[model samples]
Target chain A: MSMPYWRAAGMTYVGYANACAVLVRKCMKEPFKSQTATRERVHFKLSQWLDGVPQQPIVRTSDDGGGGGGGGVGKK
Target chain B: MASGSARPGSMRLAKLLYGNVNSYLSSGAAGINGGGAVWGSTTGLSSAELAPFGARSASGQIVRNRMKSVKSIQKITKAMKMVAASKLRNIQVKAENSRGLWQPFTALLGDAPATKVDKKLIVTISSDKGLCGGINSSVVKYSRALFRLNGLDGPDKDVKYVIVGEKGKAQLQRDSKKLIGMYFGETQKSSICFTQCSMMADEIIKSNEYDAIQMVYNKFNSVVSFQPTVATMLSPQLLLGDQEVTGDLDAYEIEGSDTKEEVLQNLSEFQFACTMYNAMLENATSEMGARMSAMENSTRNASDMLDRLTLTYNRSRQASITTELIEIISGAAALEG
Candidate 1:
């Protein structure tokens, strides 16, 4: 089976789905748009551990208000 | 001399830890030999009867301390219960909505039991954080049972694992360490989304070639109950091989320039994501429900222990007060005589 346009672009399904989800979120009107934005807001802190001690954590955040929607949330 | 006194005190503490209240009270006589100053309270001290009273006050102190700790724990569990309850309400609604995303696909594809698959991938869904009752363990247990049932418990079996949370990974790593192929976590920190599910699905598909995928998760039956369930997704090759020539799927027509094989392939991949999305949402809802009930049970247990501890403390206090009163009355009688 041939790969979809997304898989052809070397993008995982998450990137494609997130792009589609952001697009849908942008097209919404009024109260829902704000609600969707609020719900979609992703913020998390990640820290690397050496030996048994935890290092300084870095906070990753995503806000699609400016239409720059896609940000990495996947951790493997 | 110091060792002699410390021995009985440690024994009393050990008894208290074991919750042997009867033996704890009976062991009061051990304090007589040490001969301390009635725990710093010399009220009506008649030299001969000092030890029992000293031990009583000490035991009372211990009981009070335990009660304080139990009360604080109850408060924490109570707060956790409220938090889980509120989270459950929000996630349950979303879970209900997500149910719609997968049903149409299942209807179109024809839900088939994967019995003849040569290779299998089992996805065990759990939460990263615990204190959510046995939901994580139950999923782990169920997955292991699946392994055992399919004769995949051997060292080299046809089945592999894709653990979706830290809790499941930790649990499965003990025995099935070699079987785990992929691990994903940090899901509990943020709310689950379709995009996240799709990402996991895509990664899982790329990880290996499996004829069948089984998702093991807890189904939220209600606020008070959850059931361990398995949802199966067959590979496109299996779907095509097992599909009947004139099945219900033939009723639908292909609209675009995409051929039948291309359409089926794309639909299968999309359906894989949808199934994962639904399973994650259900597992999340079940996690909340499990946590709420677990916290509720913990709070109840704390309250029960508190009640028993309070009673013991009050009784000890009353006994001390009665001893003082008896001493005062006897002194008065002797002086009058």
Candidate 2:
């Protein structure tokens, strides 16, 4: 299953993980949020996982030479 | 014959007294002489009598103008103090939040082998603007001290500088022009972001010049104080080298087919960017904190100046009024005589 939300928005996996770490801290509350050591450990582990993820290949589509004709021209 | 002699003697006495008073007024003792002395009998006194009052009024105008200008400056400093206080709040939060991304890496890198290399790159983080009370100078001073300690101040030293702000660049260039490598101007919004750190990292990586990179920055201690700090970014080779990792490096399993070297390289680069980002955030927070305190001091100083100027203005104004009143009362007495 493809997870669109997991895709990094114009950032490398490391950048994305760092950003997530900041967000996680920002979203947390009270004592849990204040635990910077745990948060840093999570950040380090996230970066490691992101480092292991396989990079997606680029997909390219070429235009057919049929010009203005629809599927009929290609079929003919 | 005795009566005629008495009238003449009285007239001579009055004339001598008038001459003495006129001489005293012309001497400008009270700075109340202006235009001419009021000769109640239609013959005005000489211009010398008017000079003292002219001087007094002119000085009074100067005091008034100074008071007005100082008041405006006080307003500006007060506004600046408020703005810096607000900005410090936000940046302090950001600095606190970004700590999670780099603290672990810093802990790991702390155990890395310390190898002495001749060539070093010192990244000095400072702000473009100056009104913030020794924030930039502290970093510059720390960098210079490091150069001195490492014998890097001389021409034979292989140290190079990457100055982030204009203030540090302007200062460090005086020490040695040849030591400067790259300079980044102030950000467009007068604030720093992670992208800027990433860009700086890319530039440093591309240079491939130094064996070790050290960052000199102001560490935010509190709203009123900051300290100059140094952090070192270890190279990938140095990190993965025979030096035993002190932290929990064994806990995370590397699953990729990529070689350990490639993984280490990527991780190091990411770590470098993260460290730079953290430094930038912390430095920005420090800058704002310093600025807030500096502006607070300036605002207080401006208020003090206003108090002094207002006192002088009031005193001068009252003196001028009293001088005028005395002149009018003495003139009336002279006319009555």
Candidate 3:
């Protein structure tokens, strides 16, 4: 009973994380960089931050857009 | 005193882990306790006894689990939509840049006019991969329908179904007997390449196995859709409404003789290759479109499933706890009686 819930939770989190990762990237992006990328990062992270950020993600990362929370987004 | 409270807690923990002993527990309740239903751990427990729990939990679990999973799924799907949108922009750019090559290419494939063009060959292009809405099936369906349209459904003379995609051939299982040749995957390795597909087309042409070479595949329209289309890959001059082949032999149509024949032959060969490239790219687009849609839908369904599951877990746990409370109260009542 709990197994399916967790699995769905894992999937939901993984999916949520995917979106959060995107949002985080935007939020993490340096404001000094391109406006669009920066705005996207900002948009992504803000919603994620508001949604109550997940403590951890099972999947390592999304490697597309040549951006996986690197450079500006990765900065604390 | 602390030990007195700790003893019941320990017993509860044991029951939670070892078995569903006290509450007339069912196997479905165990679905939460263990990794999954497949595990033997769920065995022996009577789910039948907990029919009320099942009925109640099923709905409540489905509802709450759906909501929680949704908020998460919505966020995820929204991200995927963005990702698909971005990838789509690039594919559109490439398709647009390559239009110069495809426009003239399709123009060369004159409309399916006149019944004189019999003895046809259909080169059905399909993606090597899967998870695309209905590209493979649509191609197979259209190919079968085309066969009917051609008035060439004789068992003695089977249509040479030249399959270009690994998945496509598989989908055309019903028409396996009709498949004369097959090709799989990208044009990288020597084992499965465009050279092989082209060779199949050429050999069939030289053998006079088929009079007209037609191709059916999805033309990538946009990121969201791919339209299945059939285009003529090769049209022999003699078959293009040219009645009485022997009548042209004595005619004065030999002005440039060798050059005209030479050019036409090269055009036929080059035309075949260009079509193959077009098909390969178009098929890739189809794969991408289908995968994107499938993933998006999966993301959504997962959310709904999660909602129901979580709800069940909570209700099942609550019902179990409530039963424990009732048991203690009843024991005291009996003592008073």
Candidate 4:
């Protein structure tokens, strides 16, 4: 039996839609990879900024806490 | 999936038939069709002040779009898997029960009436579009394999095909040389057509035109997966590849509805109608399931992309701020000097 002409067009449209959809995904994939790279760069920059700050001394003295030891520590 | 199978020379003829869609995708390339989502609004509090979701031109925008699109696809696939599962449950039940019925029916009748074989036809049913993974392609390949077995590639093979859905039409239309006839839009009709499908079947069966008939369709196995399978429309023996077994007689019952022979006589039609009815429901459910999964994946991807974009915007703004601050301090020190 023969089918309606419109149905053929409709089916074609579906193919058209699928074809479009698939190609779109193919196009989107490359850009997505770029986005990942950009994100990684941002993280790299942030880490650099944190590393620029000062660092604490490896060792410390107790006398520094007494403010030059103006007053006696053991005897009144 | 229109025909539940792929077309001959599909790879070679890709441009001839599906070229229109290729053009359409190109036209929409700037957006999701190309590589990016709509830039959307970059307005409001100025945290990042990126353009609107639909307005951006940067890679960030494309990233957002792609992420969203992929997530949606995953969601759709997942859902399709589930739907196929439920539909599979019902279909499998029917298939199991019908197998028993078909066994006896075929045994009694020996073989479906060959009336007057002349015309050759193959009807393949698939969705208009494709999103489900291998559901359509596998069926198409299966159909092609059958034709190959039947010597369609040989000079003597004069077979004709009538596709039942959009996907099948696409594949067939691409490979026009092999085609003898076309039937489109059977699925778009108001209902799963036993009457129409049977009419089509009757045309071939009653006329004895076609030597054999086959259907390639997605058989739901579980909620997460579906198998595209080929079922024989004529000569189940072809698909089943089994030897005919002639056994003893077992009479059927019929009070007012006529005897078992009556039903058995219509069994071919009955089976055709049942196949069409069940396939319609199952296919729809599977389609919806795939779409649902695709959409959910898109949503998640969009959110992730937005997060990354916001981070970039903030860092850029902060860098600009720090530069200004350092300049201001240096200028003041110069005045003091």
Give the poorly placed runs of model 4, Cα more than 4 Å off.
Answer: A1-76, B1-120, B152-155, B189-208, B235-265
| Kept native contacts, fraction for each prediction | 0.11, 0.01, 0.00, 0.00
lDDT string for model 2 (B1-337, tens) is 2232236668887887787668767765544343244432123224333344437776566566677877887788778779888988988998888889878876766633234556777888888776787789889998887766667344565767777776887798775566666666543243455544654565466555666778899888898778788887766676667345523455567674545555566677788788788888888888888777777777777788889888888888898899999999999999999
Tens-digit lDDT string for candidate 4 (B1-337): 3122224445545554355455555665555543323222111112243444444344354445555664565465455656545654554554445345334434443443222223345556667666544555555676666555656345676566655566665665565434525444534333332223333333334333455555556655554566665554443233233233212223333456443333333444455444554554455445444434443454455456657766776666567679889999999999999
Write down the C-alpha DockQ for each prediction.
0.20, 0.03, 0.01, 0.01
Q: Which ten residues in a row have the lowest lDDT in candidate 3 chain B?
A: B187-196
Rank the models by TM-score, top first.
Answer: 1, 2, 3, 4
Residues A1-76, candidate 4, lDDT per residue (tens digit)? 3333432443222222223433444456676855432211100000000122212311111123421111111111
Q: Output the TM-score of candidate 3.
A: 0.53
DockQ for model 2? 0.03
Tens digit per residue, CA lDDT, model 1, B1-337: 2233236778877665455434444666647544354332233223443435436566665667678888998999899999999999999998999989889876777665436566888889999887887889999998998777667444445887778877987888887877776677676566776655765676667657788888899988898788898888877776776557226557778675655655566667788888888899999999999888888888888899899999888988998999999999999999999
Q: List the residue pairs that clash in candidate 2.
A: B31-B52, B32-B53, B33-B49, B33-B50, B33-B51, B33-B53, B34-B50
Deviating ranges (above 4 Å) for candidate 2: A1-76, B1-56, B111-115, B152-157, B188-191, B246-252
DockQ of predicted candidate 1: 0.20
What's the ranking of the predictions by lDDT, best on top? 1, 2, 3, 4
What value does the TM-score of chain B take for model 4? Answer: 0.57
Residue B33, candidate 4: Cα error in Å is: 32
Once fitted onto the true fold, the runs of candidate 3 whose alpha carbons sit more than 4 angstroms away are A1-76, B1-92, B113-115, B152-158, B185-209, B239-258, B329-337
User: Model 4 chain B, poorest ten-residue lDDT window?
Assistant: B36-45
lDDT of 2 at A7: 32
Per DockQ, the best of the predicted structures is 1
**CAPRI band for model 3:** incorrect
